[model samples]
Target: MKTTLVLAMTADGKIADVTKSPPTFGSDRDYAHMVEQILLADVVLVGSGTLLDGNESSEVREPDRALIQARIDRGQTPQPPQIICSRSGKIDPQLPFFSQPIERWLLTTKKGSLDWIERASFGRVLVCETADGSDIDWQAVKVKLAELGVENICFLGGSELAASLFAADFIDELWLTICPFIYGGSAAPSPVSGVGFTSDLAPRLRLLSVDRVEQELFLHYQVEKKSEDIPPT
Candidate 1:
């Protein structure tokens, strides 16, 4: 029932260069490490922006590697579930991922998206009511994931969703790939889109490990609230 956020960023502190593209700006070794984590997860979650692949967000291919094969060896059929958070259900209908009846979960707050959810009912889409009793309480999304038997969740993060999960105090760990250069200007997006929202205020992180691939640095932090560890700035 633990949530882990996995992301790759640049040393300039940019998750996306300037276009919000992903699985990019990483070294070969870093990519290998990412595969290892994906293989160990019980569910892979991403943002709708990521799958959309517009001029704002770039395309990312499905990860296929030895870890998936190992999952099969361990009797984990198919693969870990794929969870996408789309407020508008604007995801591409033509995505090849929809071609199969795989276990894919979508989280949305729109009542109109119900039809889209039904259209994708071949998969599972949850139309959730908000926390104020008015809209979707996305903070409960992972709670639902846990109830559905998810043990490990790898959030292939961009920024917005990661910020939300952080605010929700659901993220237990973080895998950040820090590159060697800065690209974005004053207008560029910050690595994490969090602002004004902090559940475990002054949150703390325990550096689980670190790896250096060429000039890039991979920082893995175990998220511990102030009760568990000293909070950071």
Candidate 2:
């Protein structure tokens, strides 16, 4: 399956205010555009934090949810199958999201020791392999998602997952929204990705388009590994 990683950051490159939370610390337009792209996606790979914090079908508003619902009504489940990438299956069992009328898949490395909550039957528990050939076993993840019939995966990643994907070269494209704001706290959280920094001294991105909405500026970049980006792993 092809993956598109979507993110919203500030002009100074900050995703959170260093607190690991949101407002996305940006402009309204950034949020709007990000939400719009998410609605169009066939599969929304949710980050564990987003799920644990109680996001529901209604959280994604008009036009977006409306567009998604139209597909659901047309015999195409519009909720886009929330595939939660959880390291450990510790989400609240009775969370309204689990009961929401949508297809949910929880991809975890373990079939965690949660006995009170029976999630095995509610959704698919994907077990990810830890290794692959000299290559980074992209197959394990791809094959499993393909088995679930996922074609386009829109990754709603937190920092850690975003870093891992970028390092693994698992991301095909990136749609980043750079909000116009400078969070100058020495410890302010960055809105930018972490992968491109470690492997290669420099990250490469092709400028796609730039849009200004309200008080924010949205910049889109395509991330790809170049000859110089490959590290001596």
Candidate 3:
């Protein structure tokens, strides 16, 4: 699938402040841009933590009516399916997203407990695991998503999941909005957080476009492979 990471970061590349909560630094235009990108995707992904952090819904909001109509004009669904990735499948069943009309799927490992089985009524529970006891194998996840006809995936969530997708080279595009603010601290969270790549093996981005709305700058980049390449997913 063509995967895109959509997020807004501060001037210092922090997605969250020292408090470790999702920052609210971007403007309405940035949010509208994100909704537009979401409308173009076949599936939307969010980490469990990100989902529970707020009462976010997978359904397209009224403000995004034009973007939703754009998708409908192209023969796409009004709202793309939303998938929640939780290695252990421990998300709260009462989360607002579960009550929305949008299709929801839980992509998790077999190691997940049956404690959340009762919540399966809310959405399809896909238990994927590997013999090595590692996290839900992303390769299997991709194949399964493909079987479900997911051609484009919009990743909108916390940095940990974003880091895994980047490390696996599963992300194709990055639509970043850089807000004109600085939340500098050692604990500030970046858009991609995990054991990152070394300088020699870092992923390179080819700038596709740049747009400015007041102080915020929207950057669209296509992930590119360099000489010292990271293998594909």
Best by lDDT: 3
Better of 1 and 3 by lDDT: 3
lDDT of 2 by residue, 1-233 (tens): 57887777777776667555554464556666666666666778866766664355323645576776776775656567777766666667667876677677766664442432454534666667464312223558788778767777888777666766766767777887766677666566554444347544445666678877776666666665655343343
Q: List model 3 lDDT by residue over 84-200, tens digit each.
A: 888887777676777787888787877674666675534677776677755877778788888878899999978899888887778889999999999999898888888988986
lDDT of each: 0.68, 0.64, 0.82
**Which ranges in model 3 have alpha carbons more than 4 Å from their true place?**
116-118, 226-233
Please give the range of 10 consecutive residues that has the lowest summed lDDT in model 1.
53-62
* Clashes by residue pair, model 1: 11-179, 129-135, 130-135, 130-136
TM-score of 3: 0.90
lDDT of 1 by residue, 1-233 (tens): 77778777666677665554443667777777776776687777777766665322211235664566788887774466677777666667667666544577777766626657548442677666575445457556756766777788888765777777766677889888887766766555664675744563755688989877679888989888545755564
Off by over 4 Å in 1: 19-23, 54-65, 96-102, 110-112, 132-135, 196-200, 231-233
CA RMSD, predictions in order: 3.7, 4.8, 3.2
Each prediction's TM-score against the native? 0.82, 0.77, 0.90
User: Would you list the clashing residue pairs of candidate 3?
Assistant: none
lDDT, candidate 1, equals 0.68
